[model samples]
Target: MIPVLALIVGVVLGVILDPTVPAAVEPYLPIAVVAALDAVFGGVRAKLDGIFDDKQFVVSFISNVLVAGLIVWLGDQLGVGGQLSTGVVVVLGVRIFGNVAAIRRHLFRA
Candidate 1:
Protein backbone atom coordinates (compact mmCIF):
# COMPACT_ATOMS: atom_id res chain seq x y z
CA MET A 1 0.00 0.00 0.00
CA ILE A 2 2.67 2.47 0.97
CA PRO A 3 4.86 1.49 -1.95
CA VAL A 4 1.99 1.86 -4.39
CA LEU A 5 1.16 5.27 -2.99
CA ALA A 6 4.77 6.29 -3.17
CA LEU A 7 5.00 5.17 -6.77
CA ILE A 8 1.95 7.20 -7.67
CA VAL A 9 3.35 10.21 -5.91
CA GLY A 10 6.69 9.81 -7.63
CA VAL A 11 5.06 9.64 -11.03
CA VAL A 12 3.02 12.69 -10.28
CA LEU A 13 6.03 14.59 -9.10
CA GLY A 14 8.03 13.50 -12.14
CA VAL A 15 5.30 14.69 -14.44
CA ILE A 16 5.02 18.01 -12.69
CA LEU A 17 8.75 18.56 -12.42
CA ASP A 18 9.53 17.37 -15.94
CA PRO A 19 13.16 16.96 -14.99
CA THR A 20 15.71 16.43 -17.74
CA VAL A 21 18.13 13.55 -17.62
CA PRO A 22 21.73 14.19 -18.63
CA ALA A 23 22.54 13.45 -22.24
CA ALA A 24 25.23 10.93 -21.30
CA VAL A 25 22.76 8.97 -19.16
CA GLU A 26 19.93 9.07 -21.69
CA PRO A 27 20.92 5.96 -23.60
CA TYR A 28 20.66 3.74 -20.54
CA LEU A 29 17.35 5.09 -19.24
CA PRO A 30 15.03 2.71 -21.01
CA ILE A 31 16.98 -0.36 -20.04
CA ALA A 32 17.14 0.81 -16.46
CA VAL A 33 13.43 1.44 -16.42
CA VAL A 34 12.68 -2.04 -17.72
CA ALA A 35 14.96 -3.57 -15.14
CA ALA A 36 13.32 -1.57 -12.38
CA LEU A 37 9.90 -2.61 -13.58
CA ASP A 38 10.98 -6.23 -13.49
CA ALA A 39 12.06 -5.79 -9.90
CA VAL A 40 8.89 -3.97 -8.96
CA PHE A 41 6.73 -6.69 -10.42
CA GLY A 42 8.79 -9.38 -8.77
CA GLY A 43 8.43 -7.64 -5.44
CA VAL A 44 4.70 -7.35 -5.85
CA ARG A 45 4.44 -10.99 -6.76
CA ALA A 46 6.48 -11.94 -3.74
CA LYS A 47 4.23 -9.84 -1.54
CA LEU A 48 1.24 -11.73 -2.85
CA ASP A 49 3.01 -15.02 -2.27
CA GLY A 50 3.67 -14.16 1.39
CA ILE A 51 7.43 -13.94 0.85
CA PHE A 52 8.00 -10.21 0.68
CA ASP A 53 11.16 -8.87 2.30
CA ASP A 54 12.25 -5.25 2.41
CA LYS A 55 15.93 -6.07 2.17
CA GLN A 56 15.45 -8.43 -0.71
CA PHE A 57 13.28 -5.96 -2.59
CA VAL A 58 15.77 -3.13 -2.18
CA VAL A 59 18.69 -5.31 -3.23
CA SER A 60 16.84 -6.70 -6.20
CA PHE A 61 15.75 -3.26 -7.35
CA ILE A 62 19.19 -1.72 -7.09
CA SER A 63 21.01 -4.70 -8.54
CA ASN A 64 18.61 -4.98 -11.44
CA VAL A 65 19.13 -1.35 -12.45
CA LEU A 66 22.88 -1.44 -11.90
CA VAL A 67 23.44 -4.69 -13.74
CA ALA A 68 21.27 -3.68 -16.66
CA GLY A 69 23.03 -0.36 -16.92
CA LEU A 70 26.42 -2.05 -16.67
CA ILE A 71 25.53 -4.45 -19.44
CA VAL A 72 24.42 -1.62 -21.69
CA TRP A 73 27.54 0.36 -20.88
CA LEU A 74 29.72 -2.60 -21.73
CA GLY A 75 27.85 -3.15 -24.96
CA ASP A 76 28.38 0.47 -25.92
CA GLN A 77 32.12 0.06 -25.42
CA LEU A 78 31.94 -2.95 -27.72
CA GLY A 79 29.77 -1.13 -30.28
CA VAL A 80 26.88 -3.46 -29.56
CA GLY A 81 24.85 -1.32 -27.19
CA GLY A 82 21.64 -1.46 -29.17
CA GLN A 83 21.66 -5.22 -29.38
CA LEU A 84 22.37 -5.63 -25.69
CA SER A 85 19.72 -3.11 -24.74
CA THR A 86 17.20 -5.03 -26.81
CA GLY A 87 18.23 -8.29 -25.18
CA VAL A 88 17.87 -6.78 -21.70
CA VAL A 89 14.48 -5.42 -22.51
CA VAL A 90 13.33 -8.74 -23.96
CA VAL A 91 14.49 -10.69 -20.91
CA LEU A 92 13.05 -8.21 -18.46
CA GLY A 93 9.82 -7.98 -20.40
CA VAL A 94 9.34 -11.73 -20.20
CA ARG A 95 10.00 -11.69 -16.47
CA ILE A 96 7.63 -8.79 -15.98
CA PHE A 97 4.93 -10.61 -17.91
CA GLY A 98 5.43 -13.76 -15.91
CA ASN A 99 5.24 -11.85 -12.66
CA VAL A 100 2.12 -10.04 -13.82
CA ALA A 101 0.52 -13.34 -14.70
CA ALA A 102 1.27 -14.72 -11.28
CA ILE A 103 -0.08 -11.62 -9.61
CA ARG A 104 -3.19 -11.81 -11.74
CA ARG A 105 -3.75 -15.46 -10.89
CA HIS A 106 -3.29 -14.72 -7.22
CA LEU A 107 -5.64 -11.80 -7.29
CA PHE A 108 -8.30 -13.28 -9.53
CA ARG A 109 -7.88 -16.86 -8.45
CA ALA A 110 -8.06 -17.88 -12.09
Candidate 2:
Protein backbone atom coordinates (compact mmCIF):
# COMPACT_ATOMS: atom_id res chain seq x y z
CA MET A 1 0.00 0.00 0.00
CA ILE A 2 2.72 2.42 0.94
CA PRO A 3 4.81 1.56 -2.10
CA VAL A 4 1.83 1.95 -4.37
CA LEU A 5 1.18 5.36 -2.90
CA ALA A 6 4.78 6.24 -3.45
CA LEU A 7 4.54 5.26 -7.10
CA ILE A 8 1.53 7.49 -7.58
CA VAL A 9 3.32 10.28 -5.85
CA GLY A 10 6.37 9.71 -8.03
CA VAL A 11 4.43 9.98 -11.26
CA VAL A 12 2.74 13.17 -10.20
CA LEU A 13 6.07 14.54 -9.16
CA GLY A 14 7.71 13.47 -12.41
CA VAL A 15 5.10 15.31 -14.41
CA ILE A 16 5.56 18.40 -12.32
CA LEU A 17 9.33 18.16 -12.71
CA ASP A 18 9.61 19.46 -16.22
CA PRO A 19 13.21 20.27 -16.89
CA THR A 20 12.32 22.95 -19.41
CA VAL A 21 9.93 24.69 -17.08
CA PRO A 22 11.37 27.30 -14.77
CA ALA A 23 10.33 27.11 -11.16
CA ALA A 24 11.97 28.62 -8.12
CA VAL A 25 10.79 25.98 -5.69
CA GLU A 26 9.99 22.73 -7.47
CA PRO A 27 13.56 21.52 -7.51
CA TYR A 28 13.42 20.71 -3.86
CA LEU A 29 10.42 18.46 -4.21
CA PRO A 30 12.28 15.17 -4.53
CA ILE A 31 14.35 15.92 -1.49
CA ALA A 32 11.27 16.44 0.61
CA VAL A 33 9.56 13.30 -0.67
CA VAL A 34 12.63 11.14 -0.21
CA ALA A 35 13.15 12.44 3.29
CA ALA A 36 9.55 11.80 4.16
CA LEU A 37 9.60 8.28 2.77
CA ASP A 38 12.72 7.47 4.67
CA ALA A 39 11.22 8.80 7.86
CA VAL A 40 7.98 6.95 7.37
CA PHE A 41 9.42 3.63 6.22
CA GLY A 42 12.45 3.64 8.45
CA GLY A 43 14.66 0.75 7.19
CA VAL A 44 13.77 -2.28 5.10
CA ARG A 45 16.24 -5.09 4.75
CA ALA A 46 15.28 -8.71 4.57
CA LYS A 47 16.69 -10.53 7.54
CA LEU A 48 15.80 -14.12 8.46
CA ASP A 49 12.38 -14.98 7.01
CA GLY A 50 12.29 -11.56 5.29
CA ILE A 51 12.43 -9.61 8.50
CA PHE A 52 13.38 -5.99 7.79
CA ASP A 53 16.27 -4.03 9.18
CA ASP A 54 16.74 -0.29 9.44
CA LYS A 55 20.45 0.07 9.18
CA GLN A 56 20.79 1.56 5.72
CA PHE A 57 17.38 3.17 5.61
CA VAL A 58 18.11 6.07 7.91
CA VAL A 59 21.56 6.66 6.48
CA SER A 60 20.49 6.50 2.87
CA PHE A 61 17.41 8.63 3.36
CA ILE A 62 19.37 11.54 4.73
CA SER A 63 22.12 11.07 2.22
CA ASN A 64 19.83 10.78 -0.81
CA VAL A 65 18.25 14.18 -0.28
CA LEU A 66 21.45 15.92 0.72
CA VAL A 67 23.54 14.21 -1.89
CA ALA A 68 20.97 14.65 -4.60
CA GLY A 69 20.61 18.31 -3.71
CA LEU A 70 24.33 18.73 -3.54
CA ILE A 71 24.67 17.02 -6.88
CA VAL A 72 22.07 19.32 -8.37
CA TRP A 73 23.75 22.32 -6.79
CA LEU A 74 27.05 21.19 -8.19
CA GLY A 75 25.45 21.05 -11.57
CA ASP A 76 24.11 24.53 -10.97
CA GLN A 77 27.62 25.68 -10.14
CA LEU A 78 28.88 24.00 -13.27
CA GLY A 79 26.04 25.61 -15.19
CA VAL A 80 24.16 22.34 -15.56
CA GLY A 81 21.61 22.08 -12.80
CA GLY A 82 19.18 20.49 -15.16
CA GLN A 83 21.65 17.87 -16.20
CA LEU A 84 22.58 17.18 -12.61
CA SER A 85 18.92 16.75 -11.75
CA THR A 86 18.61 14.26 -14.54
CA GLY A 87 21.45 12.29 -13.07
CA VAL A 88 19.95 12.44 -9.63
CA VAL A 89 16.66 11.32 -11.08
CA VAL A 90 18.45 8.31 -12.44
CA VAL A 91 19.70 7.59 -8.97
CA LEU A 92 16.25 8.02 -7.48
CA GLY A 93 14.97 5.72 -10.15
CA VAL A 94 16.53 2.90 -8.20
CA ARG A 95 14.28 3.65 -5.27
CA ILE A 96 11.31 3.61 -7.56
CA PHE A 97 12.37 0.17 -8.70
CA GLY A 98 12.59 -0.99 -5.13
CA ASN A 99 9.16 0.40 -4.42
CA VAL A 100 7.75 -1.50 -7.35
CA ALA A 101 9.40 -4.65 -6.12
CA ALA A 102 7.93 -4.20 -2.69
CA ILE A 103 4.53 -3.45 -4.09
CA ARG A 104 4.61 -6.49 -6.31
CA ARG A 105 5.74 -8.78 -3.56
CA HIS A 106 3.12 -7.50 -1.19
CA LEU A 107 0.35 -7.75 -3.73
CA PHE A 108 1.43 -11.17 -4.99
CA ARG A 109 2.24 -12.80 -1.70
CA ALA A 110 1.01 -16.37 -1.72
Candidate 3:
Protein backbone atom coordinates (compact mmCIF):
# COMPACT_ATOMS: atom_id res chain seq x y z
CA MET A 1 0.00 0.00 0.00
CA ILE A 2 2.72 2.46 0.89
CA PRO A 3 4.68 1.69 -2.24
CA VAL A 4 1.59 1.98 -4.36
CA LEU A 5 0.79 5.37 -2.86
CA ALA A 6 4.36 6.49 -3.45
CA LEU A 7 4.16 5.41 -7.07
CA ILE A 8 0.95 7.35 -7.54
CA VAL A 9 2.38 10.42 -5.89
CA GLY A 10 5.53 10.20 -7.95
CA VAL A 11 3.54 9.95 -11.15
CA VAL A 12 1.36 12.90 -10.14
CA LEU A 13 4.42 14.95 -9.35
CA GLY A 14 6.08 14.00 -12.60
CA VAL A 15 2.98 15.01 -14.53
CA ILE A 16 2.70 18.32 -12.72
CA LEU A 17 6.40 19.12 -12.91
CA ASP A 18 6.95 17.91 -16.46
CA PRO A 19 10.55 17.18 -15.73
CA THR A 20 12.87 16.87 -18.68
CA VAL A 21 14.68 13.63 -19.31
CA PRO A 22 18.22 13.72 -20.62
CA ALA A 23 18.27 13.24 -24.36
CA ALA A 24 20.61 10.28 -24.09
CA VAL A 25 18.10 8.43 -21.90
CA GLU A 26 15.02 9.12 -24.01
CA PRO A 27 15.22 5.89 -25.97
CA TYR A 28 15.42 3.68 -22.91
CA LEU A 29 12.51 5.18 -21.00
CA PRO A 30 9.79 3.03 -22.47
CA ILE A 31 11.73 -0.19 -21.85
CA ALA A 32 12.40 0.89 -18.29
CA VAL A 33 8.72 1.60 -17.76
CA VAL A 34 7.74 -1.77 -19.12
CA ALA A 35 10.30 -3.45 -16.90
CA ALA A 36 9.05 -1.57 -13.87
CA LEU A 37 5.50 -2.60 -14.63
CA ASP A 38 6.67 -6.20 -14.91
CA ALA A 39 8.27 -6.01 -11.48
CA VAL A 40 5.20 -4.38 -9.97
CA PHE A 41 2.87 -7.03 -11.27
CA GLY A 42 5.23 -9.76 -10.16
CA GLY A 43 5.30 -8.28 -6.69
CA VAL A 44 1.54 -8.13 -6.59
CA ARG A 45 1.33 -11.74 -7.61
CA ALA A 46 3.77 -12.75 -4.89
CA LYS A 47 1.67 -10.90 -2.33
CA LEU A 48 -1.44 -12.74 -3.44
CA ASP A 49 0.41 -16.02 -3.14
CA GLY A 50 1.55 -15.28 0.44
CA ILE A 51 5.21 -15.04 -0.56
CA PHE A 52 5.84 -11.34 -0.71
CA ASP A 53 9.29 -10.21 0.42
CA ASP A 54 10.27 -6.58 0.65
CA LYS A 55 13.93 -7.19 -0.07
CA GLN A 56 13.11 -9.37 -3.02
CA PHE A 57 10.71 -6.83 -4.41
CA VAL A 58 13.18 -4.00 -4.05
CA VAL A 59 15.95 -5.96 -5.69
CA SER A 60 13.70 -7.12 -8.47
CA PHE A 61 12.49 -3.61 -9.15
CA ILE A 62 15.96 -2.13 -9.32
CA SER A 63 17.44 -4.97 -11.31
CA ASN A 64 14.59 -4.95 -13.80
CA VAL A 65 15.00 -1.28 -14.53
CA LEU A 66 18.76 -1.52 -14.84
CA VAL A 67 18.70 -4.60 -17.00
CA ALA A 68 16.06 -3.25 -19.31
CA GLY A 69 17.97 -0.03 -19.74
CA LEU A 70 21.20 -1.91 -20.36
CA ILE A 71 19.60 -4.07 -23.00
CA VAL A 72 18.32 -1.06 -24.85
CA TRP A 73 21.68 0.64 -24.60
CA LEU A 74 23.48 -2.37 -25.91
CA GLY A 75 21.01 -2.69 -28.72
CA ASP A 76 21.67 0.90 -29.70
CA GLN A 77 25.40 0.32 -29.76
CA LEU A 78 24.97 -2.82 -31.85
CA GLY A 79 22.89 -1.21 -34.57
CA VAL A 80 19.85 -3.31 -33.68
CA GLY A 81 18.18 -0.94 -31.27
CA GLY A 82 14.71 -1.20 -32.69
CA GLN A 83 14.66 -4.96 -32.83
CA LEU A 84 16.03 -5.40 -29.31
CA SER A 85 13.66 -2.86 -27.87
CA THR A 86 10.74 -4.65 -29.42
CA GLY A 87 11.96 -7.97 -28.03
CA VAL A 88 12.39 -6.57 -24.54
CA VAL A 89 8.98 -4.95 -24.56
CA VAL A 90 7.30 -8.08 -25.83
CA VAL A 91 8.92 -10.30 -23.21
CA LEU A 92 8.23 -7.99 -20.31
CA GLY A 93 4.71 -7.23 -21.49
CA VAL A 94 3.91 -10.91 -21.64
CA ARG A 95 5.18 -11.43 -18.09
CA ILE A 96 3.24 -8.43 -16.85
CA PHE A 97 0.02 -9.64 -18.43
CA GLY A 98 0.57 -13.10 -17.03
CA ASN A 99 0.97 -11.65 -13.57
CA VAL A 100 -2.15 -9.56 -14.07
CA ALA A 101 -4.12 -12.59 -15.08
CA ALA A 102 -2.93 -14.42 -11.97
CA ILE A 103 -3.90 -11.46 -9.80
CA ARG A 104 -7.33 -11.31 -11.37
CA ARG A 105 -7.85 -15.00 -10.86
CA HIS A 106 -6.83 -14.75 -7.24
CA LEU A 107 -9.06 -11.78 -6.55
CA PHE A 108 -12.11 -12.80 -8.54
CA ARG A 109 -11.89 -16.59 -8.52
CA ALA A 110 -12.96 -16.53 -12.18
The candidate that wins on lDDT is: 1
- Residue pairs clashing, model 2: none
Q: Identify the runs in model 1 with alpha carbons over 4 angstroms from their true place.
A: none
Q: Tens digit of lDDT per residue, candidate 1, span 1-110?
A: 89889999999999999999999999999899999999999999999999999999999999999999999999999999999999999999999999999999999998
* Structural similarity to truth (TM-score) of each candidate: 0.97, 0.54, 0.96
Rank list by lDDT: 1, 3, 2
> Tens digit of lDDT per residue, candidate 2, span 1-110?
67669879988987898555347546766654654454334343232226554665556667766777777777778999887777667656666666656655665762
Clashing pairs in 1: none
Q: Candidate 2, residue 39: CA error in Å?
A: 8.8
Overall lDDT per candidate, in order of appearance: 0.97, 0.62, 0.95
Error of 1 at 59 (Å): 0.2
- What's every prediction's RMSD, in angstroms? 0.7, 6.7, 0.8
Clashing pairs in 3: none
Off by over 4 Å in 3: none
Clashes of 1: 0
